[model samples]
Target: MPMHPIEVDDDVYALLQQHARPFVDQENDVLRRLLGLDGSPTAVANRVSGGDLRALIDAKLLAPGDELVHIQTRKGLTHRAVVTADGNIRLPDGSTYAKPSPALKACVGHDINGWGQWIHAQSRESLQSLREALRERQAD
Candidate 1:
């Protein structure tokens, strides 16, 4: 086995960090995954999809400790949570969800797109809108 050093911009580094688990995932593993190579014998990673709110933290659009609320459209119910320091969603019941979807499921007791469901408490911006804005920025 050989090792080499490479340089990437901060954003790319952030993406790599997001995928790399400390003491569990390595840089080579991250790179291999990015290149569509299977470096592990285990099943595929359980990665959260496009609506993942962690991206907001990475992009600095949202910060640790920021408040978010999910307003269930049909039930007219509201659930509140905060972003933990490590970028996980922390609900009032003291459970942490790695992504917004499951947290939302816990809230509404049903399946829903968390991005569209979760709104920033301060900005009132939906996670989907934030994602779209990020995409637009990248496209520009």
Candidate 2:
């Protein structure tokens, strides 16, 4: 899709960022969602609900209530989220994300490799490491 650029002042830009779903939502997506132009609310819900966390949960790599932390050292920011029983990620803002990438995006306002960025709080391991272990185990 071709994207067009538009300018907004800091406040308006911050507002747009506040309503965005991180990596999942571009500015247009947020505007569309807010204006009810993104189809049925059910469709919006479905879009946010599908994620990769369930595979980790099923493989016993992560448990419900586990905390994940993302630290942007250069930016001096640290964001945290918890794993839900259903394998969704629950952000501090009380929003649940089905995947780590969008969850991390919600924190940093851009895309980053979530599997590498989110640290398993207890283990101090990256989600990427856990995923690799799971893959290795499955291949065995």
Candidate 3:
């Protein structure tokens, strides 16, 4: 097999190292596992629904009842959602969505990166930013 050199910043390199399996000697192997290409095709998406947000709650990345707001730039209406006790998301009108994007679409009437658009009430940052912070902490 041939090897290719890819450039990564310090943070990404740290993330790869943090996720590298202990017994993996090759960088490719480590990267494969980190990327969930080591045989689990649905691993990344599955982990998103289960582990990622759960870990955030466990690590206190977000608190229950934390409001997630999306401001519709065109409509000029602010949509609000709350994180439930069980980590499910509930929209302003009492409708619930398991994922953020749908909830955001329901709120704002458009498709968007809910993770990037939904602002965390406390942190005043996007959910995407918060998730990145959680991943960064794991890397450390």
lDDT ranking, best first: 2, 1, 3
Candidate 3: tens digits of C-alpha lDDT, residues 51-120: 2345567789888788888777887878888886555576544445556777687766778778889898
Candidate 3: residue 74 lDDT (0-100): 84
lDDT of 2 at 48: 56
What's the best-to-worst order under TM-score?
2, 3, 1
lDDT of 1 by residue, 3-78 (tens): 9988889998777777675787676777675443443221122232322456677888888889999876787878
Could you tell me the lDDT of residue 95 within candidate 1? 47
Best by TM-score: 2
Off by over 4 Å in 2: 1-50
TM-score of each: 0.58, 0.64, 0.60
Lowest-lDDT window of 10 residues in candidate 1? 41-50
Off by over 4 Å in 1: 1-51, 73-76
Candidate 3's TM-score reads 0.60
Task: For model 2, give the RMSD to the true fold.
Answer: 9.4
lDDT of 2: 0.79
